[model samples]
Target: MKAVEYRLPKEFDKSFIVFKEQGLYFPCPWHYHPEYEFVLVNKSSGRRMVGDHIGTFLEGDLVLMGPSLPHVWVNDQKYFEKENTETADAVVVHFLKDFLGENFFNLPESEPLKKILNLSNRGLVILGHTRYQITKIMNAMPRQNGLKRLSSLFEIFDILANSSEYELLASPSYMENTRDMYSDRFSKITEYILRNFHRDITLKEVADQANMATTTFCNFFKEHFRMTFVEYLNAIRIGHVCKLLADRDKTIISVAYECGFNNLANFNRQFKRLKDMTPKEYRKALEAEPMIA
Candidate 1:
């Protein structure tokens, strides 16, 4: 399995760091960081894996990740093709809990800011009009320095603290175990599963990959991921199928087979169980969209 990589900003001495990059994939492997992160996807689209949550992400998506959360932005392969004209871009801000000094949150003036950081503990996805407002703040980060940068970060947090237009992505149970020591093991398992999910994977295969007994692997996975091994595999398969469905010319039967289902009946059943809609309905909905945004 490939090792998970995390990019920490260099040049900034403060607990909070902000940086931007162009034409570069973040290359974040299913790794976690001690500091909280706010990532704005200005121009990229791919599968977004945060904790146990998986979804299709696009440009203008803004995500807030809490401390010790595992995540990665796997850029689509098509974007990296030689003939492709567009490149990936992003703005990321990372900060520790004590970035504002030890007593800052306790101060009366910092009440709102404290609330915002607290809300971020569960991880939030800012959407609708709120995303644009935050993007403006991020757009200005590159020009600021010293006290100005710190002040701007505080202002951004204020907006997040007061906004009600965000959604929490991780479950409360997962949030409670943020400090659990099994993250590395979980990362190994997930990385293996993600890499080999397209093939026929069995319990022994995954368990051996984790270097644990089948029983132990099952118990550990359920305890941390909140789902059984089969459940997780099916979820990944369904997510892949959705991506294929977006291509109008693809046939439902072909997509089902390509996604690793042994038979169409099994694929249809699993798709309906996970998505609550048939493949035809799912494809039709995508066609109805005027645009992906």
Candidate 2:
């Protein structure tokens, strides 16, 4: 079993730090830290895991996460292949709550900012006009220093605190202190599930991998994932199936089996259950929208 890595910022005297990174892939694993983070993905597409939430993120993705939240952006396999020409790029900002001062948020005028900070504990995905606006600021922060950079950060907070164009990434009931989630048993189980969800996985096999009885494994999975094991596996499959459905060439039956569904009836059933629409309806919605190639 592998452990979720914990990371710390390099020893520095500053109140905050910003990084502009470009690489073949995002190398960070499931990890958490004490500093709040603002990350802007300037290039590449990938799966983003924030707390118990899992979804795909594209270029121009921007998200804010509060202290001690587990998160990572895992690039697709193509990004790591030797012959791939593209690179992944991002701008990340890290700061302590007291970056301004220990009591800055106690000021009467800071109420709005305080509220935004509190909501960020569940993680925030900047959207609509706000995302476009922040992309510029985040890209510029890596070049500025001193008061100029600090002012830019304050401006960012002001924009986010005032806008309604954001969504919480994690659930309100999501356990933030995931020490138990990072335990050796849970880590091994998660690794196995993510790698093999598209195959015929039996409860007994996974339980054996976790060195737990099947019943104990089921309870443990529900406790951490907030869903039944079958539900979690279906969600992972449906997420990938949605991705494949984007290609107009793939038939529904083929896509279903490709994503590991053994039967069309079961595939359509779980697809609608998780996505609230049948595969055909989902494809129709996609067709109606003029998606950019």
Q: What C-alpha lDDT values do all the predictions have?
A: 0.72, 0.78
lDDT of 1 by residue, 1-293 (tens): 11244658657456578888677455555567778899898897886656544556899989998777666677776775788887788898988767767777678777766655555665678898888899999979978888888888877878876787887664332353333233676667777876777789999989998889999989988876567988878877876787677676788888877778887788999888765668887676444322121
| Model 2: ten consecutive residues of lowest lDDT | 284-293
> In model 2, which residue pairs have backbone atoms overlapping below 3 Å?
none
* Top lDDT hit: 2
Q: Can you give the lDDT of residue 69 in candidate 1?
A: 67
lDDT of 1 at 57: 80
How well does each candidate superpose onto the true structure, as a TM-score? 0.58, 0.60
